[model samples]
Target: MKKNIWLDGLRSVARMGETAVVAAKAGIKYATEKPSNAKLMRETFESLGSTYIKLGQFIASTPSLFPREYVEEFQGCLDQTPSLPFSYVEEVLASEFAGRDLTEIFASIEEKPLASASIAQVHAAKLVSGEDVVIKVQKPGVETILYTDLNVLHWATKILEKAVPKVKFASLADIVEEIKTRMVREVDFIEEAKNLEDFREYLQLTNNQAATAPRVYHQYSTRRVLTMQRLYGVPLTDFEIVKQYSKDPSQVLITAMNTWFGSLMMCNSFHADLHAGNLMLLEDGRVGFIDFGIVGQLNPEVWSACIAFMDSLQKTDYQAMAENMLKMGATSKQIDTQVLAQDIERLFSGVLMADPQELLASKPSDLNDIMMDMVAVGERHGIRFPRDFALLFKQMLYFDRFMRVLAPYTDIYADQRLQMQMDPSLLLKH
Candidate 1:
């Protein structure tokens, strides 16, 4: 216990130093050259240790909450950090497995990691019984580091929220709170294992042959280590590879979209982070979803409101849209429906009036514009949206961009393949 306390103190000191250095570096770079703000921001976040790394990931996932440049730039901030040496991996393995040799359980384990992130690194291995697996090993002391960093961040955010009201649309406190929730969950590999299994089962039950998630080996898994099947595929961004495998790349994309849209209603939680890196096209013409570290859960009430919002968007019912958002997100502060609708209309009126074919051809993504409008609306009315609604809206914005890239000729809102309906029990029962 004394050792643990000492370690925590050391972590706190390290985090503060790191944060300062990162902040200084960012300030220097911004002052010296007009570098891409998104790139500089991501680099600074990476330097601030695990908490900010996770925050960068969240920003990469949430297009609706940030500007387009930031979202697109942070996409490069994948788990690309250097891994701990193999000696560290071995020490962790022995300590966790009661001094047993890795060979005792695995027939073979690769020294080279398949991928390394801020918190963990994955290695390809085979179980002694001959099953192929990918082992995800957590870096030592990551939990302590993450905890200390988040605590410091909470204080920092509180200070910033008081000092700067408009650094970005989101208050520093709210953003830090959201980051804490996600980072805590990410530090536990067991939870991710469960998420992987649940998603696999959901796909199986739904007979979703178009896509497949990896299978987890729960027996060999722990809070720090996860063993799962390795999936081989090219990321969806490689249109050339996708074309070589499938007759039509757009068909694969549609299947992926349809599968995800269905899961939003049927599954308990859906994969909230579906960037090009996380999605792939396998050799067998199936979409592969990798990484379940961050999933989003929609309560029944919120799900109902989301359905209403999507339907309203399709029908251009701005009043209903405003009402649904208020119910789903706002904290009791009344917003004038007519005023909100008028604001929304003003924001989208030009885009809507453009020829449908032109809209499809140009493939205009309006997530940043929409978020700016939302911020305007929020400032006009004292309605601060909860974090969950912010996350859902971010996912919707990502889907909108994905559809534009995959099928630019199709109207994403009116896509017959995407299912937006809700189950009766979800809304009414809860």
Candidate 2:
């Protein structure tokens, strides 16, 4: 045990030294070329590997806390990662199922990965029972690298904040801590399996037949290997294929939105990352929600505040929106609701007045810009939203983008199908 600890310590030191060299080179290049800071940071994160790649994705999703350019730049950080060799993947599977026979557990697992990301690679497999599935296997040494990289990142954020006080607005240290908590949970396949199961249960209980999450095979799953029911489908972003699957793609968006909104109230946690890749149009015309790695849990008070905020937005009640925003966030000092209302009204009125067609043209980024503007204004009033709130808001923005593509020129706020109000009975049951 002591020798293992010593080896780990040595590895951590080596990783830190390597990171420092890479960062120094990137910094010198940035200083000389005067390229956009967002581009430079994105490149640096990509070069640094898993932990930074995940961080970049977080930044991309979190428009509520990051600047528009940074958020836009990091959007490229989705799942663009190099794959590990089949031998390494086989080694991980053997280690994860040490005593069990691989042939007994899985009839066959494809040598080539179906997909590869920072932490894991997925392979198409068939079980002994003749069921098709996918096995998500964690890469060797990823946890150690994650720990070392996050420690270095946390340290760097502290130093940067101390050097530049202006960068302290969104609280970089708190964000890093939040990332650490989520990423740590992400590496644990057990928790992700639970998330998938819970979501599946929520769908069953609600009789939501239009949308589904991948069914987890708990018997074959472990901390490092997750075996789930294979969902064959094209991505939701593949509009041509989606149109072929569903006659009215607009209804697909509606079904997805309603199902997701129901989960917010019914499930223990909500899917925080609902990018185009995570959502798919299945072979049977059902909307498939996959990738339960990152999720958000909101307390009752925050959830109530969120519902109220959405209700207020539908009604254009800026005062109510401001009050709910205060309820949803934390601050050391009190803020004036009236002033906050004025600021929100001023920011949103222009967005609300824009032609729907033009808004649809911009789609995702337009809504992101509006949310960022609101965050900027809220920051001025000393209102800092919780991480959960930001996650929820980001998902909402994603839905808004989908709406533009599926139901062009539709007003999401006033849509009759959208249940903006939370059901009191559902709240009590939860």
Candidate 3:
């Protein structure tokens, strides 16, 4: 049924009023607190609620787009909102399903949530057809709130840009728009369900059996709700529990690494958030990848550059490494390739001296430091990276941590069993 234009108009007016009231309260609180710019923004976002918390997370994750101070400050932006009452869940389901009786589709939906985060909550459920599954229900009123907050943010960003025309802050409106696009996608369960299906297809196309993402149940899924096959497993971070499933946990980790590497080329996008919580070791001995909320795609040129970069690294060719780094980034200034090579060459000497134990340390922060150092060298020469590169780099650090826990002695790069897939043309450089 088409929505009534008059009702929508009324709702829009009321929503704007609510937004004004909320912004006023936050502004008053800020005035009273009188905190530092970065600190105050973080605090204000936390106090505001879910949409703002997600904005904080965007700042934390996209280090390339944010100031180092802001990025570091927002690192503490964690989502820990209390679960909404099950009655709200039911109402959301009923609305999303268009008055369809949920009992007709679900044999049971546990009132207790499996997990609760800013945008959605997951609950264990059984389908009427007897399939054990998980239901991910988007919070009611999230769309309205998200739009209200983002529109306000967009205007504020434009005002800041106009007021401080000479500031080095890169296109504030563009950045906010980017954030809006990402957050809007996050609230759309239909898109996430599609991501799940695409990943599963990639696995099948590549004949990969070692790692799998949950199969989405589209028949019961909607724009606001997703139903997926339930996966039973221990998180990959739980070393002891993982060891019970497989004697050689290192191989399992390697299998996961190889599968993910293949997906970078084979799939629509790579899983951008594959930290401990998102990867699991299942009872059936397969690695389970959960949460399709965030993923990343690279343009063909950047991807080719990545392939060449890896191949160059394997060959220890500093000139090629420097060349590849230039290709992977965008810069507006002239750069001396020879000088860049020298800096990268010197930085890599320290890299070579890095102990394998430290390189594969369980603490990802160690590996992250190394990645940042490399990026710093590039930045000093006026070459800045995109957020996709950071996502790719972060996943590498997660893989390093897994190696630390599972295969302490394994030289992952030199291991023949691990297929770090790159382009066929680039394989010749190896």
Candidate 4:
């Protein structure tokens, strides 16, 4: 035990020294290049590898807590890490499926990965039964590396928070903790497989056929390896191709939105990450929802309040919206609803006043600015939103971006097709 402790101490010291060297290099680059802080920080995070890449993705997804520039810049964070050799992929699969005959389990797995990301690589394969599937294989030692890098990042965040007290409002350590929790879950393919199953159940229970999530093959899946039905489709972002799949892209957005909203009320958890890449127009005409790694759950009260908030917003009832937001967040501190309403009105008035054409042409950062401004106003009014709420809001922004391309002139909020009512049983059970 003593020897193990000594080795760990040495490893920690080495990591700290390495971090210092990287920091020094980043400082020198910033000093010489004088690039924008957002650009410099993004470059530094990219160079730092997986943990930082995940952090960048977190920042991109959660605009409520980040500055618009940093959020926008990190949206470009690349997840396409170079693929490991096929030997490593096979070794991972063998370890995951120990005691099982590989030949009987899979007829063939393509040696080349269909996609490679920081945490896992995906390969197309054919099952023994002749079903086409995709295998998501976790990279070797990713868990160890993730924990090590996160610990180092946690330590550095503490130091920086101490040095710069003003940054505390953003809750740097808390953000790191949130990221750690989510990323740790992300690396667990079993949990993700469960999420996929839950979503599939939601669709079946609701009798909804407009959207679908990948079907997991639990018999062949393990903690670090996921086997799922391979989906072939054009990404929703490819508007031209998506148009070929659907005559009306506006209905596509509506189906996606309604299905997702229903899941928030019906499922155990909602897909927290619904970026454009994860949504596709499948060949069979159903909208495909993939990548169930990051998900969020809301308590009964929060879900009810969210529904009320949406109804209030649609009616342009700012006071009702403020009250619903406060209820959703549930702060113990005394808050004046009238003042909150005024603040929300002031914040949204600019958005309401913007010309439709200009709004459609605006970038994601522009939408983020409006959303973050509302968050800022809420903060001033003692309204603290739950992280799930932030995730949901970010998804709304994503849908807004999609609408810009799919239906430029449509009013998504006013669409009659979206049914916000919930069955009393679903609302009461939780």
Candidate 5:
């Protein structure tokens, strides 16, 4: 044990030294460059690689935490890294399945990847048993690099906390913690497989057939590798193609929204990533939910109050919305419900209820504005919204955008078809 501890201590020092070198290089770029702070920061993050890219994404999504310019610039934090060689993939597979002949496991795996992101790459493959599958293989040294960067950031946050007086970085230790939690989970294929399995079970229990997630192949899955049934479909964002597959595209979007909303109440976790690529309209008329890496869980207070909040919104009850928003979050001081209601009224009165054509014709994504306004309101009221709430709320905004494009004129909140969770018992019964 003493030897192991000594080795670990030496390794930690080496990792920190590596981090300082990278930081120094980033500093030189910052000093020499004349780009805006946000743009330069994003460029530095991209140059530093995976952890910072993911951090950039977090900043993009959680606009409530970062400055407006930073949030807007980070929105373009793309993670389309060049795919590692097929030989590198074979090495990882061999290391994972030491004694097993990969030939016996997979009949064929395409050398070229269908998609390659920072942490992992997906390759189309066929099992020896003739099952079509997609293998998500984690890149080499990803976890190591992730840990080194996070450790450096965590200690930096701590050092800043002591060195600076009420500096913004001192307040940002929580962001580091949040990033650690998320990035750790993202690198764990086992957890993502469980997320998919749990959602599959949720579908079975609820007797729902309109939506489905890819089946996880646990026998072929490990901490670093995930194998799932291959799902073929066009993205839901492609309305033209979606219409070709389904008679009514609006109904498909509605089904997708309802299925996702149902999962919030009935499932262990909800799909937190809101992107066009992750949601698809399968050829057989099912909505395919893919990429279960980032999932969200609401605490009991938020769960119960969020339902009421949705219900109140459907009824246009601003007072109830204001009260329930408070319940969904926390505050150390009292807030006037009437004033909060008026603030919300000003924000949501016609924004969410805008004409379908008007919403569709808008040039920019208004969801960011809506999110910022909501966060600004929360700040004013001293109601610190949960990170999970930001996630779920962003998802709702994505659905709202889908509604505007695919099913405009339909108020998703007021639509009876949407199981907006007015009754918690309905979830339990399912």
Candidate 6:
């Protein structure tokens, strides 16, 4: 009952603040001789707090599903806001550990954060035993804010859907459910610890050294606190630094691609979020993966269908591609495979004939043109791709974009270029 009272009071305050914000936004738009809408939105979201920032990050990550304007605008919302103070950090640590002081276990901790996202901020530290580590502390009251915001957002979405009929197909409630599942998982650092350990085991079993995930110190970790081995490197998006390590950036890309692709087949879950920020090129010449907040798993049937879809794309077998896509996606009715094949072939014939490098350019117009074509094809076939498939497809599109910046000449599908660093014994046999 107390919790309900607190939540109700929070919602009332939020609604009042939201009304003021909306009014201010309206006035800003009306008087706009020069208006930076993105900046305004970012400031408003920051004022609104954690939930909006988290949603902004989601929009930035999901390119295929959102508008170009929104995607480009939200890219600036990568948690540049000020982090909670050291006092708050100490409080979180104390709360999680129950009366234990941070200095008791760690010889030193740098209050300056390495990275600060919506949910948590990471700090570099050293254990008393002399191990260099990074501590991730969940900001106080973030979960409460998230729950409150989610509830309010759900109500707003329902209201918006009622007013706008076109969005009825993509139910707002479903999107909220998906985001809630992922966000709740993110607040629990213990789950991230497990994900890191499982990924480490996967790498060991595969004998892959092209990339490295952080090592978790489970003893000191909790739902709100995490201690991991600190990694030093450049973000993978830094082409200039990546070129310093390898003469052929194309090979570096191929290794990164194959390493991640192999995990989909060999591991229980695959990293769903592989944006450039989450990937790093370490000084030791290894890829560093950080942030395991969102992941994807596939049943065997879906996995088989995905493999078949890839094989078909490689073969340029449109009929097989259509079949695999149908099997992989959800459909309300049986569709004609032959017609779908014809539609896909027509859409991609010109595209497939072009140099892959040309297609990889992330020019907004170029990407929009292709996406519009896919929607057209979907309309013709009476088939809608599932959100999971769209998520994977968008990741591939970003991979293509990265290839343009990191490696121009690489053939992503060519056999000589497509080598998996994990289990190179197969390479020796070939």
* Best prediction by lDDT: 2
lDDT of 5 at 147: 83
Clashing pairs in 4: none
Q: Highest TM-score among the candidates is held by which one?
A: 2
Per-residue lDDT over 1-430 for candidate 1, one digit per residue giving the tens place of the 0 to 100 score: 7986897788778877877887988899899987888888888887765667778877765544667678767766756787778888877677678757677799988999888888888889999988888888988888878877778878877777678867675466776777887788888988898788777776777667889988888878888888888788887765667788898777777778777766666667778778776788898989998888878886656767777875776677778877886766655566688888887666556655633233233322455445546655655666655555555666665665666556666665565755565444543422
Model 1 global lDDT (CA atoms, 0 to 1): 0.73
Could you tell me which residue pairs clash in candidate 6?
Answer: none
lDDT (tens digit, per residue) of candidate 4 on 1-430: 6975675666656655766787799999998989999988888887766778899988876666787788789879988799999999999998788899899999999999988988999999999999999999999767766788889878888999888888844488888998999999999999999999989988887777888988999999988999999999887776788889899988898898888888888788999879887888899889999989879887657878877876776567889989987888756689999999998877766676643334334566676676677677877877777778777777877887888888888777667986655576754543
lDDT of 6 by residue, 1-430 (tens): 7985786678667765775676587567647845566656655666666778777766655544565566667766756457878889988888788877767889998988887777888899999999999998998777777787788778888888888878824577777877788788888888888888877877787678888899888889999999999888786676788888767677667777877776665666777778787777778888888777667664446656766766776677889978987877667887999989988778767775744334445454466456546644765576665555545555576677677778766556554757433353542332
Q: Point out the worst 10-residue segment of candidate 5 by lDDT.
A: 354-363
> Runs in model 4 with CA error above 4 Å?
1-21, 161-171, 354-363, 425-430
TM-scores for the candidates: 0.82, 0.89, 0.87, 0.88, 0.88, 0.82
Off by over 4 Å in 1: 1-11, 24-42, 57-79, 158-175, 300-304, 355-365, 400-408, 411-415, 422-430
Each model's Cα RMSD: 4.0, 2.9, 3.8, 3.5, 3.6, 4.6
Residue pairs with backbone overlap in model 3: none
Model 5's number of clashes is: 0
Q: What's model 2's lDDT at 5? A: 81
Q: Determine the C-alpha RMSD for candidate 2 after optimal superposition of all C-alphas.
A: 2.9
Model 2 pairs in collision: none
